[model samples]
Target: MTAVGDARIRRAVRAREEGSDLPGVWSAYGGLLQHLRIRAGLSQQQLGDAIGYSLELVASVERGRRPAKAAFTAAADRVLEAGGVLRVLQDEVDRAKLPRFFRNVALLEAEALSRFSYDPLLVPGLLQTETYAHALLGAHFPPLDEEIVEQRVAARLARQALLTRKKPPVVFVFIVEEGALRRFVGSDAVMHQQLEHLVTCARMRNVELQVMPAVRSVHSGLNGPMVLLESMDRRRHVYVDAQGVVSVRSDEDEVSEFWLRYGMLRTQALSTEESSRLIERMAGEL
Candidate 1:
């Protein structure tokens, strides 16, 4: 499961378990640990044998009720041939209040050198204004209790720091459909504020924003909203968020195709100057 999905489930479970939300999020950390063991071709008994735990303890980890140790993660990484992906996140997990899955994404984002995104519906989380984000989050079913909403929004807003940090600024390129620009997600005032913020954010040196005109007959982004993230280590991942599903892929060919499509879409989009003017015009209509 994606980190966001894991976080959703963790929130539900936590709400029930504590009778109120706690600041710490621990989505399916146990399950991820167990899956790593299974993928490493180790039986539950074998994993228990290596980690000096009973098979029942191992089972508890799989069920998300218990926290796995760093030593266990290191041992599992070696056995699983994960090249320290688990180890790196394990370190951050120690200090993080973010859910397990979200922590993984944070580690990945911290290492990323560039990101390219397309959003056909709402603004991407990394770029959302607080008001816009809160309004959208409030609409989620099983409605995020106030504390959870606050935490999630704060977490997302914190991610924007990547744009300004020293050296190798996280290059960001965004493409949004004209329809997204037209939608008034919140009140007219809130939506107008968000659009104006988009205009200012787009002008940042390391950021690029483009709008896909609704009238275009031939477009490369027909498949819907997707993101292509690249790290300095030459790794690539494809992320798609649609129909209440968010997925990330590390498969080379799969991400490569999305990268190619993003290139084509960029070519068809209006120049940055034109897009800014277009956004400003839309903001005026509000």
Candidate 2:
């Protein structure tokens, strides 16, 4: 049993009593973990011993005070003989760490046959190096727990695997603002590593990396960042995120508008070779 004096346990109990929907999915998932643990006739301490965690850590996760990480959940599934029930929730848990609305975008991204993105701030997730990602996520306002931060970093890195799949996407076009490259994310060392990674990604046959110059007289992307995705079935969708709210549009008219806007932005941006040169120059500065 969790110590009654533990702050996390007390907070979980209070939230439960207040009927707060905060962390709803995670709480439900935690409940499922608790149920399975009991069914296996394993005490929390016993489960912790088997999984190489502390009893309090197990209790915190079971009560929804802490997130169940991918590795921990996998161990639980195996120990409890859950038959993949717990393992299947790993993706959901990862998605839950993202802005609630962006979860859908992640799903679409995974199945996209082609993806085009125009980013005016920060490196796009798919192109971010692990150190850059950790720095970016660690800087979130309200300060996420270390466990949650690590989970998000893992999730972002996992998404990059799509680019290396046996049947990689036909096209992956990324137009980044010149300022994003100039801005340091974590440290000089981290930025150097990230820019180096970006240069390598630009060399991929199916990838086109362009940079929107800061001095551009006419900028179509002044409105904000957006992504255009074509699904495996050839259906198109547009996604825009602002102020923590994400809007995904599947309407043909809206998608067409975003497609045209992205084309104009790409044309106004530097050529691939120029972008590569710019990236290399910035990396050299680091």
- Per-candidate Cα RMSD to the true structure, in Å, reads 11.8, 5.5
Best-matching candidate per lDDT: 2
Residues 160-261 of candidate 2: C-alpha lDDT, one tens digit per residue: 877776675557999999999888889999999999999999999888999999899578898999999999999999999897788999999989999998
Q: Write the per-residue lDDT of candidate 1 for residues 214-251, one digit (tens) a residue.
A: 88767988888887888889899877766656678899
Tell me how far the alpha carbon of residue 39 in candidate 2 is from the true structure, in angstroms, after superposition.
1.5
Each prediction's whole-model lDDT (CA):
0.74, 0.84
* lDDT over C-alpha atoms for residue 222 of model 2: 89
Worst 10 contiguous positions by lDDT, candidate 2: 1-10
How do all models score by TM-score? 0.66, 0.85
What are the runs in model 2 whose C-alpha is more than 4 Å off?
A: 1-22, 142-148, 167-170
- Clashing pairs counted in every model: 0, 0
TM-score of 2: 0.85
Model 1 superposed RMSD (Cα): 11.8
